[model samples]
Every structure is written in C-alpha cells, then in structure tokens.
Target: TVKPPVETVEVSPPETPLIPPEKERAPSEKVTPPLEVEERKEVEKQKEEEIEVEVSREEKEEEGKGELKRRPEEALERKAPERRFSIKTIFSPLTTITESIRKRKRRTTALEEVGPPLVKPKRVPRTLKEELPPADWRVLKEYEVRGGVAMIRIYLDPETSNYIYWVIEPPLSDVEKDNLKRLKDLLQVSLPYSLEAVEEERREKFLLEHLDKVMEDYRIKMSENSLEKVRYYIVRDFLGFNKIDPIMHDPHVEDISCDGPGIPIYLYHRDYGSIKTNVAFPTDEELDGFVVSLAQKCRKTISVANPILDATLPNGSRLNATYGREVTTRGSSFTIRKFREEPLTVVDLVENNTMSADMAAHFWLAVQYGESMIFAGGTASGKTSTMNAISIFIPPSSKIISIEDTREVNLPHENWIAGITRGGAEAERPGDIGMYDLLRAALRQRPEYVIVGEVRGKETMTMFQAMATGHTTYSTMHADSVKSIVYRLENPPIGIPRVLIQALNLVAIHKQLKVKEKRVRRITELVEIIDIEPTTLEIVTNQVFRWNPRTDTFVYGGHSNLYEKIMDMEDLSRDEVLEERDRRAEIISWMVKNGVRKFWDVARVVGEYYEDPHRTLSIIEKNPEVEGNPLEVFERAAEKGRKEHLKAKSVAA
Candidate 1:
C-alpha cells in the first residue's frame, strides 16, 4: 500500500502555490511611475502646501467672526486627486447615484424657500417741472388718466379767500414721483401765506407760458378771429375754470339771447318759462360778440348780406335771428321756440281743461263718419292739438294721408301715408311742391281721409276740392268764427267760394280763454254748414250745447242732425239710437267708476264696441246688476220703438 501511494503521489500535488504578500497588495496602494517619480514627489509637496493653506483659511474664518478681516480670495488653491484609479472606476455607479440625489434635494429646498418672484412691470412717474406754474398752485384732485396724460385739478387762493380751481395737463415721466414731491414742497411754502403781491407779478408770466397752448386748441376749433374774441370774453366773464362744452348742454335753458355787445345776456328758463338769468355782458360790444358766437353755433350767417336767419338747432329747436342793420334796426335779436320732449295727447288736453268731453265725442263721431271738418282759431289756441286728438277716430281699415310743412300729425293707424311739402328757396323758384301739390297728389292716391296741418294760401281751394271728391278731410285755419273762416277763404289769396263752404260738414271754433289766471282752450261754437243763399250762408247752431263762460260746463242739446244721420245709417229708430248713445255714455261712466278715466282706455272700449257690437252688448248684459247696465236700457228702448212703429203702420193701414 505504501509503495502504491508513493507511486501515485509522485509529483501528485505540486502543493498549491501560495501567493506572496507583496503580490496581494491592498486597494490603498499607490502606484508611481519610475520615470515620473520626481514629478510625483513635487505633487505631494504641493498637496502639503495646500493643506497648510486650508488650515490658514479656517483660522482666518474663525478670526473674521470676532473682528474685522481681509477677504479670502488668495486662500483657495488647486489640489491633486487623493486616490488613484481608472476613470471608469473612479466614477462608480454607487458614488454617482448618491451625488445626484444630494444635488436634487438641495435644489428642491432652494425653490421651496424662495417662492414665486414678483412679475409686475415698473410704473412711470408724472412730473410738473418744465412748465412750472405759480408756487401757490397745488394739486387738489386728479381724474381720467388716459393716453399718458393726467387731468390734474389745481387750486389757487385769491384775495376773496375763495379757492379758484383749474385743470392742468401733466406729462407722465420717470421723474414724476420726485417732481410731485418738489411741487408739494413749493405749495406748502407759498399756499398758506398772503402771496397776492407775488401772484400778481407772476400772473402775466404764468399766463404767457400757458396761454399759447390753450389758445392754439381754441383756434383749431374756431377761426383765429373768433379765438381772439373768445379770449376777451373768457377774461371778462371770469370763465377760466368753466367748461363751455358742458354749459352748452344745459337742458333747462330754452333760449340764449344777447341783444348787443355790452348788453345784458338773457336765458329763457323752462321752469320759469321766461328770459332771465344771473349772467350778463358788460358792454354792447361784448353782446355783439356773443351773438356772433351763437349764430356760428347755429351754422348760419347773420350779417348785412344775410340779415334774417332761420335755422334748426342740433337739439331740434327752431331758431330765428335778425342782424342789426339788415333785418332789424336794433343790433341783433333772436327767438328760440323750444322743442317738446313729449307731445300732448287727448287725455292731456282733457286733464288740463283745454277741451270738453262733449266736443271731443262729437269730433270723434265726425271723424269716424268721414265728415269734412275745419278747425278755426287764433294763434296758440291748441288748433293742432285738437286736430291731432280728433284724427285718432279714423277707422283702422281706412287709408289716411297727411300733408304739412313739417311732420306733425302722429296718428296711430295701420294704413297711413304722411307727406311733407318742400319750401322753395325764392318766390320765383319752380318745382316747389307746396300744400297745393300735396293735396293734388293726395287725391290721386285714393286716400279715404286727408289731413292738412294748416290751410293758409291757395291750398284752401285744393282742400275744398278734396272734400268735394268724397274724401274726408280735416284742416285748421287762422280765424275766430265761422264767419271769419268764410271771409278769409273768400278773400284774395284763398278765393274759396261761399257755395264750396257747404261741402264742409262742420266748423269748430276754438278760442283761448284766460281762466283762473291761466290760458285755456275751449270750443266756443260748433256750427253745421246748412246752406248758402245768394247773399248769405246759413249755419245751423246748437247754442245750448255751447260752453258756458259763467259755469265752465258744456251744455247738451236734445238731439242734432248728426245723431239723426247715425240712426238712419244703422237702420235704428230714433229711440233705439238714443238708447245706444246712452249705453255708450253709461259704459264710459262705468269705466270711470273703475278708476279708468284715461282717454286711451275710453278709446279702447269704443274700438271694442265698433269691432263686435253684439259681443259688447252680451258682455254688458252678463255683468248686469253692476252699475251702468247699458244693454238693458238698449233693449227697453228698442222694444218701445218697435211697438211705436207697429202702431204707426196700423194707423196707416
């Protein structure tokens, strides 16, 4: 066994070679190239020198905390890598991951601590330095910052202890903040003391500095000549702080009149309804200048060449002005009739006691039956208002045509055509379609009704012709009575014959009466055009139905020819027609009882009855036992009429 073992183990396990300790060197071992040994030694020495520098820097930092010290700019120095390894080995995955995580956390903490940075843009400042005003002038208010300019309100203390205000234009700039502080300092020094002497001395200087710019603006708006005149007035009137544009927009002023240059200016107030104001001019020259300014505003010349001027204002008001030497011997005169914001209606007339209910009702029936009516009255007798109110009775189905010099008729109808005549420039001008032309054209249009605002001239003939041709026409003339109307029509300009007057169904004379210290309109007479004899025209009148001067009440007659005509047309007996009239009155009374006194409500009820008479009757009967049982009265009157008619027939048989 020993021999076999020795034979097998012969060279059997060259004992596993043991590695030498030098060959198994640790990772801390530093490899140095033999050729660069001196360089490595120098590098080591430099690292030692850097260690000394770091120690000194630490000592300096400690000393700086307790006392003043110099900067540490020369302390930091470059150093070599501590450990030697391959590039890939030096930047290992583990080391890289740890360093990246540490850097990310530091950035997150910094962002959290700082929050969002401010993003507002810097503001520009406003300064008042170059165009330096008086030292006493200080800002009182500021308004309307626009286009890099601010409207600054400044105050000045005058001798009267009153603080006068002025609007100043200030530029926005970078030094505006500092400039404002300087202005405040100047104001504080001079504003509280009596600086009138200084102010007077500086007045001309300040005015000269700013007047050019202000005058330039005014000159751009007006001519150079006008600017000169306006400047004089501005100084004379003490209107330096007032806004002329806003003054022109005063609504309570009906007119602004100035007779001559130093004359007193007058303003007609709507509330007072007269020409009176606290404002006035010192001299006739000033008044003349103001007159010229007003004329310019009207956009019409009022010189010797154009003496008389008539124009419409921007506010829809009529203006009339006369030049001194041309139209009038006096310097300059003007009158402005204010435009109405709201027009008067039938109810307004009634409420104002301008017209009676009976007159209104009669006119209503007249207009409804297509009868020709003429309204005669003096100036301001509410002729047009009465005409307008009566025109509302025209049927909805009828075609209406209105002719006038200016649009005035405001009738509420579905089928209506309004025509206005064009005034000729001169007497010899042709193609001027006056009222005559309008009347002729209206006839060709086949209108059921024709309305002429005012009949003045040969237009009377055309209106009469229209009435003769079966058109229901309405017109107003300037007169006091039916006789006067006839006289005026038959006179020179309007030669309407007496026989033609018979074509008119009725003539209503309206008069302005002074009652209770107030002017009121009343229908004095309502005459029927009965006949025209050789030398005289006959008019049938119901004086009993006239308005009484003593009692201020309108009297009623038993029956009129108009009532007969309506009865005949409806095939109703006299009693039945009277009953129908009473029924209508009762309905009106009921409406008044229900607190419906308005004319529009009355009109609506009347229109409903016209639309469906049977339905209206049934509605009235259903509500019997209530006040104003109109249907019961109608039925009773109708039965009585039937019995009377049968009795008459029996007597004839």
Candidate 2:
C-alpha cells in the first residue's frame, strides 16, 4: 500500500496575497524594498528556530522516548506567529526555498514509513477430467498404463451383461489442443529427417529432446507437470499407435481390431476375451489416414489403387488392413495381432494349464531328438503361441532358421536366422519373395531346424521335404484335426503328396472352448504319424494325448512312439527311457513351481541341462523352492560355457 503524499500549509499575514504575482520578475531583475527585506530576515530566523525544535521533537517521538502532546489549539497558536509578517515580506527567495525543501523532505519521510506491497499468488491452470465409463457399469478391473497418463478399465455393462474395455486419457482442453497443433506443425519442420532410422530404444529420448528445443524456441510456457501431460500425447501419437496406444501397452491385450470409421475399436483380452473399447475415429478421413500411417510405420504403402495391406509392424505385431470402401463396405478396417516381446516358454504353458507337465516333457524330448511337428488349430486358438512355447525346447546349440510372411516367432537361441517375406511392387508378382522362397533358401543354409510361421501355400511341400531330409521342422496350420491338416496339406494350394506327409512325426491340435464358463485354449489332441496303410493308403496315427472336456485334464494314451525311438537311439532300456522322461517331467514341474517362465531364463536352464544334466538335477533337488532368479545357477553355467567356447575358438585360431 502507498501512503498518501504529505501536504503542507503555509500561513501568510492577512494583508498579504497567497498567490505569486501575475507579472513575475526574475531574481536578478527584481529589487526588494529595504523594510520588506529586513522583515523577511526576521521571519526566516523565527521559522528556522521553530522548524529545528519541531524536528527534534518528532525524532524523539519516533524513537519512543516521549509523545508530542501539544493540543490542536496550541498548534494553531504557534502558526499564528507566522501571520504577524506580510506574505511579500516573508516570501523572500530564501524563505520560499526553505519551505519547498521542507515539503519534499516530508513526502520522502512518509514514503519511508510504508511497508512492502502485497503480491497475489499465481493461479494454476485447470485441466480437464478424465472421461469415465457409464455410471451403471461396474468396474471389474482398473489399472494404470503409460506411466499413469492412461488408464484401462474393464467394466461390466449391466444392460447387456457384457464386459467393456474402456481406455481413459486426459481430455485435451481447448488451449492444449491449439498448442498441440502448433507443436506438431513446428516439429514437422524442425525434427531431423533421419528420425525413422533412430533405434527403438533411443527414439523416445531423441524426440523428447527435440520437442524441448522446439517448445523453448517458440516460447511455450507451462508447468512441469503440464509439460509431461503434453509430452505423453506427443509420444503416444508420434511414436505409438494413437487411439489404441493404451491398449497396446497392456500386456494382457493380444489383439486389436477396428471394423470401420465411427465404430468402437475392439480388443481381445487374455482373460475377458473379445471386448469393445471406447476409443474410435469418428470420420472416414481420420481412419483412412490412420490406416495409411500404419502402413507407413510398417514401411509399406496403401492407397485406393492397392487398398489391402498385410504386413508385420515394427514391434512384430501382425497387421491386416484394407483401405477405402473398395474392398470393405465399412470405409476402412484393420486387425492387429500383437505378440509378446518375450515369447512364452513351455514352462509358461504348463503353468497356465494350456498343457500339462507330462505333455511339455514329451515335447521337450521330441524337440531334443529331432522330431518334426505341426501345430494345427482354428484362428485365435493359440496355435502360434503354443508352437513358439514348445520351440524353446529345441536344443540351444541347433542351427535354426525361421521364415514367415509376418514376423511372429521369437527365439532366444543364438544360432538362429529370422527371415520375413517381401511383397512384389506389381500385381504380376515379378519380384515377390514369398515364404516358399525364404524356406527354400533356409534349407540351403543347412539349418539343423526349420520353423515356418504357417503353412498355407506351396511352402507346405518344402516344409515336408525338409522334415523328410532330417531337418527337424516346426510349423502351424489352420486345421483343427490330423485329418483336416492332411486335407489342407493334400489340397490345391499346399498340395503335399500323401507319401511326404508321413515325414511329420507329431501333430498337436489346439482348440478354443469354454471351460467353467470361461474361454480357454487347450491342446485337444497330440497325435503321431506312424505310417501309411499298405492296402487302403490311410495315414496311420497314434493318439498320444487327448484333452478331457468333462474334467479339464489331459489323458495319456499309455504309450508313445517317442519313448520307443528314444530307447533305440540312445540304446537305453525301456525302463531307463521312461525314467528319463519322468525326470524331465519333474524338472518342468520345478520350473513351473519356481516361476522360471521367461523365454531367455528358460533357455538358459535348458542349455545348462544339455551341457551338464547331473549338475542341473542336483541343484534342483537341493533348492526345490529357489528364492530369487530361479535360473541363477543355470545362468552362471551358461556364462561359463560361453567363455569356454570362446576360448576354444581363440586357441584354434
């Protein structure tokens, strides 16, 4: 607050005028009368004496030594003394200068008495609330993703008794929307041209640094927390799948589908199955642009001329899209099949009850002994997952090659080659590198094991040829039974000869069925191909394992040719082979119990077992309930083996 400026009153004689003369004269030109000058001198002397006394008294009062208790009447009487002289007599230059100096001093003293001015606190900018699910819906689960920038809510709709997948993100305020548009515009021009070439791990950091530069240059102002909220959106849209980014981040989500514009996107939850989400593009242009962006992200192109795009995303998710309304009536559509970064292991399968420990052990033995197998199942029946899980059983030292139209198989083996097919530029297929080409080339590499993502075309024949040539192969197919697998194999597109089918020694049929009112995937049957009947030419088979729907358990057929083969190849007694199988089964059970299910962790343990079985078994027997990092012992063993291998190579050189 400012104190009022001090105002001083000058008392003049009653006969003298209070205002200056209209015709003012300069000091040099004016001459004062003798009587007036003498009177001014006397008046100035009296005023100086009174001023010094009043100033001394005021200073004493300020120091709290005493109070100036002069009455109002006495103050008036003191001023009355000044009225004895005429204004012209007392208004000498010296007297006027003294009065002006006194007034300025009073004003300065008043200002010094005031305190610091008040300051109002800054107002925090408000943010929009996150949108919520319907009031009537009950939330089954709610979890944070994208570092709490987004949330996933699984709610049950009372009206339809269906679960809804709801994605909640901070709603953009009008100011934020404008700022985002500006930022995108600025970033387009300022960002480095080689952004796409950045490594996946460094891309986020790079973009964040670039964004900071751009925003700073443009003079954007925001709180640190507000800046982070904006950064989340920028990263989500620029580096991730815009509308479905939250769902994509969710580990439990396996698939995401967009039927068309104005339709809610759907996602497949591992526990809740298929559910409709709350995010969608409301306009055809928006969806078409998104689809085009997806194609570009996959390093492919889609347009009205060639509307359909089937490719693998950078993160190894399978993307199938159709552009425009030419092929699909509902504007544009897409389906993404997201695979886990760390593929499931056989131990994970056993833990999830997708297959029993016995079945996993059987696969472990078969895969170890170079037995070719095929996983047959309907769509979304966990065919590829099961195939991948069992693939971890392949001996770690084996040279493996995998070819696919879209990348899905992920392995922890070092001696592995991953190949993806490339499409031709034209419809005539002049330069198309199909899966068959990759598979054929892989065989030339002399891989000890071959993995085909799926057998839907002529590649099936090459796969069977590889199996016959003793290159233990694994693949998946869109068939639910051994007969259906045979039918597809012997049909036009695949067209494998009946004699060549015998090369496949094992087939695992997977099916999706409801058990205990919940949808689940199970290996319905594990069958083996024995031989072709001489007279009827029917493919003879042995049922090694079958799932019992009533009890949700697997029943062993009591006999396995795999065991007989093991006995002959290893030259061990039948009891000895059985005991080994049982021991392997026990090891699988221990892994499941101790939660050693990560792909690389399982691979380390398996490799250690191959390098030294007795040591592995003894470790497990001693520490049945291993505390932390269940594969610690196995990892140390693997590390030692690596050092030895490197040393031997160096010595040889």
Best by lDDT: 2
lDDT per residue for candidate 1 within 1-653, as digits (tens), equals: 11221112112111222224466435443322222333345456544221221111112333322211223433122223342211221123555434433433211000011122244332223322223545765544334322222232334444433332232332333333332232222232323233233455574344433444433422224445544444433322222212222223344444556554333335544332233222334433444455555566555566767666655554545567776645565466666555444445555555555555555556666777778988889966778777887676677778999987655577667799998765421212476667777788889999999999888787788889888888999988899987788788889888987778778888878897866654467877777775666554554444325668888777666656677788878887887866665665455444434444344544555666676565555555554444454444444544555567689989999
Query: Each prediction's Cα lDDT score?
Result: 0.54, 0.77
RMSD of each: 30.2, 20.1
Query: Please, what are the lDDT tens digits per residue for candidate 2 over residues 92-158?
Result: 3555534543443211000011122243332223211124555888999999998788888899999
Off by over 4 Å in 2: 1-132, 424-428, 633-653
**Model 1 vs. true fold: TM:** 0.51
Clashes of 2: 0
lDDT of 2 at 260: 88
TM-score of each: 0.51, 0.77
lDDT of 2: 0.77
Model 1: residues with Cα > 4 Å off, grouped in runs: 1-324, 424-428, 534-544, 578-609, 613-653
